[model samples]
Target: MHHAFQIADREINVALSRARTGYRLHLGERIVPVDLRTGADGRAWLTLGDAHIEVVVATRGDDVFVHLDGEAHHLRYRHPLDRLAAAAAGHAEDQIRAPMPGSIVSVAVAPGDAVTQGQVLLVMESMKMETTITAPRDGVIATVNYQPGQTFDRDALLLSLEPMETCA
Candidate 1:
C-alpha cells in the first residue's frame, strides 16, 4: 500500500510492497530492503542493509510516535481522501474520531476542559496496541462522549472541540 505521512514538517511518500525476503520500502527516490524482528523485550529491531536499529513505537489516532536511538519523532499519517475532504471543508477539523476500532483505555478530558494542541485526550488499545489520541489544535473541549473501557468503531465520534478563535 502507498501512504503519505507528515513527519516534523515534511511530507513523505512511502510505498510498501511484500518482497520475497521480507518487505520493500520505497522511500522518496530510493528503494530499500527492510526487515523487522521483535526482541524478547518487545522492542522492534529494524534492519536496513547492514545497520541494525532498536526502536520503540506507539500510535495514537492518526499520529505515530517513534523513539529511535534515544531521539523521539512524531509522525502523522493522512489518507489522501481525508486530505482532500479537509481541503474542501475550508477549515481544519474540530472533531476527533477513532481512526480504527478500539477500546478506550483512558479518558483525560471532560466537557469545558481547555486543551492545547497535542495534549492527549485519551488512550485506546486496538489490535493489542495502545494509541494515544490528542487534541489536533488548541481548543476547549465541548464534549467527551466516551468513558474508559468503552469500545468504539472506526470513525465513531469520540469528542469535539470548540477551537480557539485564533485557530478557527
Candidate 2:
C-alpha cells in the first residue's frame, strides 16, 4: 500500500510492495529492502540491509507513535480522501467539525481548556449512535461554537483550537 505520512513536519511518501523475501519499502526516490518479524513480546523486529532493529508501535486514531532505539516518533498518516477534503475545504487542522448531522449530547471542554492530543472534547449523537469528538493536537481551546443539546449539520464547525505556545 502507498501512503503519505507527516512526520516531524515533513511529508514522506512511502509505498510497500510484497517481495519474495519480505517487502520492498519505497520512500520517495529510494527503494529499500525490508524484512519484518514479530517477537514474542509483540514488538516488531525489522531488518534492513545488515541492520536489525526492534520497534514498538502504538496507534491512536490515525496517528501512530513508534518507539525505536529508545526514541519516540509521531507519525500522522494523511489518507488521500482526507487530503482531498482538506484541500477542498481549506480548513486548518485546528478546527473541530461535526462528522455528521448530530445533536450535541455533551460538551466536555470549554474555551481556554488545555487539551492533549486525542482527548475527548465533546459527544454527539446521530442515528441514535453517539460519537466522541477529540482534540486533534495538543492545544488550548480557542472557542466553542455549540452547546449541549444543540443540533449541528455535517461538517459544521463545533469548536476551534489554538496551538499551545512553547517556551524558548
lDDT of all predictions, in order shown? 0.79, 0.79
Q: What's the lDDT for residue 22 in model 2?
A: 91
TM-score of each: 0.49, 0.49
Off by over 4 Å in 1: 86-168
Give the per-residue lDDT digits (tens) of candidate 2, residues 45-148. Answer: 87885689998778998899988899999999887446534533422577777655779999999998898877989888987988777776788888999999
Give one digit per residue, the lDDT tens place, for model 1 in 66-119.
888889999999874465335323226777777667799999999888888779
Candidate 1 residue 110 Cα shift, in angstroms, is 50
Q: Least lDDT summed over 10 consecutive residues: which range in candidate 2?
A: 83-92
Candidate 1, residue 149: lDDT: 88
